[model samples]
Structure formats: structure tokens, C-alpha cells
Target: MELESPQRRSTMRDAPWWRPLGPRAPWVAALLMCAVLMSAALFIRSTALESSALVARGMANVIMVAGFEAFRDADGLPDQAALDAFLASHREGGLRYVAVLEEAQPLVSAGAGKVGTRDIQDGSPLRVEGARARLIHRIRRPRPVLGPLTLEETRAMTSVGDVQEPRKPLRMVYEFEPLTALELESRSQRLLGVAVASCVGILALAFAFSRSLAQREALAEELERGRRLAALGTMSAVLAHELRNPLASLKGHAQLLAERVESDTLLAPKAGRVVSEAVRLEQLMNDLLGFVASGELRRVDADPNDVLRAAVETTGSSRVEVRYLPSRTPWPLDAGRLQQALENVLRNAVQASPEGRPVEASVEHQDRSLVFTVKDHGPGIASGEEERIFEPFVTGRLRGVGLGLAITRRIVELHGGSVIARSHAGGGAEFRLIVPARGV
Candidate 1:
């Protein structure tokens, strides 16, 4: 069975719900979330401002009405001394001036500034207006009785003004200056800054959470792939073991048949073909078994150049060009297993190169690790199949069972090394094998 490629596996799996927006999802989500928070902050600020304004107006009206009631006598007529005393007590309480208007004429005035009849008549109840410095005022008409004044009583008394005409109902006007626009603006800006800062902090936290979740998801996926590969290795080992005996018996019978067949007869060629096919099958079984098998390594300190030369000689290829950069210190490795792994890679490189084109092999030390590189001049590995080619039974060629690279990888891994394949800059495939200088 073919193992699934990493790309195919990822594509087949369903992505997390939050991943639909792709890599920039965090930034996009953060911006949109912050925008919504800012809108809410603005909305809340507007609502709070409106509420505060309403409360201020209501309180001011209450204060003015109370002052008017305090100045009135039981007969419901304003007393001059009482009005003066009430104004004096609340002079510093944001109350600029207070006046009593009778029939569009000022009757009793207290505090600063002279009051005009038109000013009292034109002023509405609890009105505020300003550009730079805000002015708020409350105009109230005092009731004849004072306590729990009703609208019906106010209208009845005003309607009978010509008959009784007791004193024209008093229009109590109170004016005060509130906060300036610049001060209020500065306060609002501070609130907005705090809201913006809060939003940024929340976005940062959300981004961190998303990053952590992505890392855990990736780790889980890697673990799952490892499990699948382990199970596959187990199954392949069992199958290879079962087929070994029968494959060996078949090869032996084919060899006996070839020996018995006469060389001059037509049966000889057919028997020879049978023996060759049987040999191929045996080799295929051995390759599969070797890939699934685990073994101990006999590590020893050896020169990397000697290993590379040995691998090149094993391939028996005259078309290979070696560029060996000798290391100062010898590398510790399993000589036999390392040579086998190198031979497999070198042979593949030699096979991949055109007849005249030289296969380039190189050895170098980098960052405490020995690096071996083999480059072929033939058609490079197909795009998106670099990692898949190392899987068992996966092949780009038509010939033998595709277990050479797989077995090579197993051997190198046993020695705690890594093998990677890529397309070379000069138009071919390149394989790099990196091994630690000290054996694991």
C-alpha cells in the first residue's frame, strides 16, 4: 500500500473552524474585533454623555424650583428678604444669577447682572447652549401653593388672573456656566485612548492564543503521522516475513530447472528467463524486509573521505566526480551501514545521470555535522514528490521495486542522521545526507 504524502494528508483533513481566513486570519480578526470594540466604546460614551446631560438638566430645574418655593410665603407671594437670602447661600454653587419676573417685568432680582423681561420670557426650562464655554439655565413659574404644584392648578390660576389677579405668577430664572468645550474634549480623548489601548491588549491576547492553538494542532498531526507510519512498518514486516520462505523455494526450483534444460534447446531460454524473474522477486522481498527491519549499529571513528570513496567505488561508475573536503576530525559512524546507505544513494545518482554527464558527489563538514551531497544531471525529481519518494514502494522509475531510498533512509536514521532531496540549481536532482560527527 502507498503511504499518503504530507500535502495530501493535510488537504484531506478538515481545517479548524477559525482557519478559513488563511495565515493572516489573526490580523484580520484582530482588526475587525478592535473595530467592533471601538464602535461599542463610542456608542457607550455617547449614551453616557446624553444621560449625564439629562441628569444635570433635571437637577438644575429642581434646584431653581426649590429656591422659588423657599422664597414664597403661605399666601404664594414672593418675599424680597427670603429671595435675597436664598440667592446668597447658593452663589458659588454654579448659580450665576436668579431673578423673579412678573408680567414680563423684573419684580425681584438677586446675584450678578440685571435681568431683562425678554430674557426671562424667552428662556425655556432647562436649556443649555455654548461653543467654547457652556451655559445652562432653568426657567420655572412658581405655583401659588408651592407644595406638589400641579399643571391644572397652574392653568386655573393663570386663567382667573383678570378676576383675582393676585400677583402675576413669578418666573424664576437661574443661569450657570458649566464646563468648557476644550476640557470636555480632552476628557473624551482620554476615554477614547483608554478604549483603544484595551482593544489592542485584547487583540494581542487573542493572537497569542491562536498561535498556541496552531502549534498544538501541528504537533498532533505530526504525532498521528508517526503512528500511521509505525503501523505500516509493522504490517510490512509481517508480510515480508511470510513471503520470504516461498520466494526462496521458488528461486531454488527455477535454478534447478535451468540446470536441467539443455543449452541448445528453446526451453533453455525460457528456463533462463524464469530463473532471472525468480531472482528479481527474491531481491524485491529482501529489499522490503530490509526496510522494515531494525538493527543495532557498530559505530567507530572513520574518515568521511574514505567512506565517500568507498561508496563511489561500490557504484562502479566512472562518470562520478568527487569533491571531498577533508574534515579536521574523524566522524563516528557505523561503517558497514553508512557505506550501504551511501552506495544506494550514489548508485541512484549514477543511474539518473546521462551517459556523458558526470554525477557530482561531495563531502564537507558544517556546524559539527558531516554533509554528503550527490547530484545527478538527468531529469530532476518531479515537483511535490521530494518527500514522497522516500516512502516504501513509491517510485519514479519503471524498473525494480522502489525500496532503495526507503532502505537507505532507514539505515541513515538508525545512525541518527537525516537525508533530504531537492532540485539542484544546475538542472538536476540533489540529495544531501547529514550525520552528526559523534555517533548517537
Candidate 2:
């Protein structure tokens, strides 16, 4: 009703939450994200480089230790030099040691027990048998050492009998990187990887949450709509019952008026028109009542073919011969309702059928359901409207009210069946329907 002044408007528009600030506004960012990252990376990288040689040597020691552990954890004793050489390599990157611990003798018996027999024979090409069944193991606590550890520091970690020392040295090896550039590089890459992974995980979570919220909102809307329809149906049912009897009486009175006068030819035609319209009105009222009780159903076992034949006869189409093989398949049916439904189908077939072309009614069994097909040579329904024609009050006829098929479908659905209309591959239209068998 009232426009704001310029000062008030500008103040309102300048609020932070309402502003669009992102990749789009590159020139003047809401704020700059100063990358402490590069500085942090430099510090870590520098520290790592200063320590590289120490780390490489430390890693080599760890490799030796790890190899010694393999011997201790093995099924039998390994060639000592080969074991030491393995540990000296592959265990780099400032790691002091990585080893597997097991009992003194591994081959004669692998399960939990004390050191047993010397099961392994001494040889360059080792020969062995039985599974090297691994088991739960533990590492020995390293004895303390107090000196600048030498590269031979790896020897202390070997299995008791593995090398030049049958009895391994009793000392813990301690080592650290001397602060170097390579360490800094490795730390920077690790930090960057962690940051990127966290950002991606955050975005994925946001999208999933948003989609879930939207689906919940849509479901809530649909449930509310269904509640409203249920209320509307109750009111319509009440109104239809009240209107039917009065409408019938009105038609009867008009008929009486037509019989009472001879000079009322035009008046008689007017009375007939009144009666005709009244009948149409009654039919429309009945259809509304039908819609209100669309869910109510009574199922029984009955022959679909018999029901279809009866409907054809009721249509009074002497020229439209109904052809169907009498099949013994019994379907779960609501007899009166099924008759009404099929009669509607036949009526549409009869209307669509060209005079000498016989409208067809066939029933067959497929899977656990019964299928009823009614086809005619009449021009096919308009392509786009095939689905719409099933709605209540939609008709193909020039003056059709369209309710015929809608009511028919309601009858079919109550019996756990569905109807569909499609163009026949051979040029006409076919209506194929399936209904579940009764007591199956």
C-alpha cells in the first residue's frame, strides 16, 4: 500500500543474508579467503626437507626391523642375509620399524606354544611342508639405548637366531628425521587431500538432505488432497439420494399432463422434451452417486465369457455379431457390476463398429489373471485422448456425456482389475482388460 523511501529501501537491500555473493562476484568478494594454506604448506615442507636424510635412514632401519619380524613370524627360519637386506630396503619415510612377531621356531608347530624343534633344514633353496598357518602374535618391548644410533641399529630388532648374532642385541632403536623439505612436501599434499575430501563430502550431504526434504513435502501435499476428496464424496452422496425421487415425480407429472389434452400437440412435444431431459438428469444424478461409492465391491467366481455374451445380447446388435470361444476359466467377479462394465464396453464397440463388421468379445486366461478383449473395426479413438476417454463423463459420441466408460472402469477396479485402450496393430481399436481370479 505504501512505498518505502530511498534511504529505507537501500538499507533493506544491503543486508548480508539477501546479497548474492559467490563465484559470480569475483571482482569484489564479500570477503577474501586468505590461504594460510600456502604458508602452512611452506613451513611443513621446510621442516620435512631439513629432515629427509634422517627420515630415509630411519626408514631403512624400519625395513630391516620389519624383515627381522618376518623371520620371527615365519613358519621356519629364513636365510639371514636375505632377511636383513629386505628389512634394509622398502621401509623408508622416517618410519623406524615395522615387524611381525612370532615364536622362536615357526615350522614344526605354528599354533600357540613355546619354542619347539628345529624343524627347518639349513639350505640355500629352502624346502618346507604344511600350511604356514598364521596366528595372533605380540612384539617384545625394546630395551633402552643411549647413543647416536648407527645404521647397524637395525640388528637389535632381528629374531633371536637370525644373524651374526645368534643372541640378538638387547636395545631399543630410536631415530627421527632431521627436519627437511621432502617432509614438508609430503605434509602439504596430505593436508590438501584431506581438505578436498572434506569439501566434497559436505556438498554431497547437502544435496541428499535437500532432495529428501522436497520428497517429504510432496508426499504431505498429496495426502492432504486425498482428505479433501473424501469429504467432497460424502456430501455428493447425500445430495444425489435427495434429488433422485423428486426428479422421478417431476417426469411422471409431465407424462400425466401430456395425456390430459388433445389440442396440445405442441404442448405434448414440450411435455415430452421435459420428460426426456428429466430422464437425462436422473441418469447424471445416478452417476454422481456411483462415484461416491467407487471403492465398494462384491466379488464372486463367474465366467467372464458368459458375462461378455450377456452384455452383447443386451446391446441388441443383431448386425454386430459377438464372437468368443467359451473358455472354462472362472474369474473373481462382481457379476452385476461386471455385466454393467462389459455392457458399457460393448456399447462403445457397437458405436465404433462399421455396419457389416462384427464387433468381437473374447476371453482368455494368461498367468493367474483373466483377460477380456473387445475389438471393433470402427475408427480408432483420437490418439491423445485414449486415456482421457476413461474419465467419468467423457464420451466419443457427438453428444456423449462420457460417464459410460468411467462407471465401467470403477466396476472393474473394485474387482482388482484394470482396463486399457490402445490402437489395434491391424487398424482398429482394442480394449484389453485383466482381472484377478476369485479365491485363487
lDDT of 1 by residue, 175-219 (tens): 654433224545666778888998889788778977876787788
* Local lDDT at 253 for model 2: 88
RMSD of each: 11.3, 16.9
Best by TM-score: 1
Estimate TM-scores for all models. 0.63, 0.50
lDDT of every predicted structure (CA atoms): 0.74, 0.60
Per-residue lDDT value at 90 in model 1 = 65
lDDT string for model 2 (319-415, tens) is 5555554556565677777887787788888888887888878777777877778888888877797778886556767765676787777777777
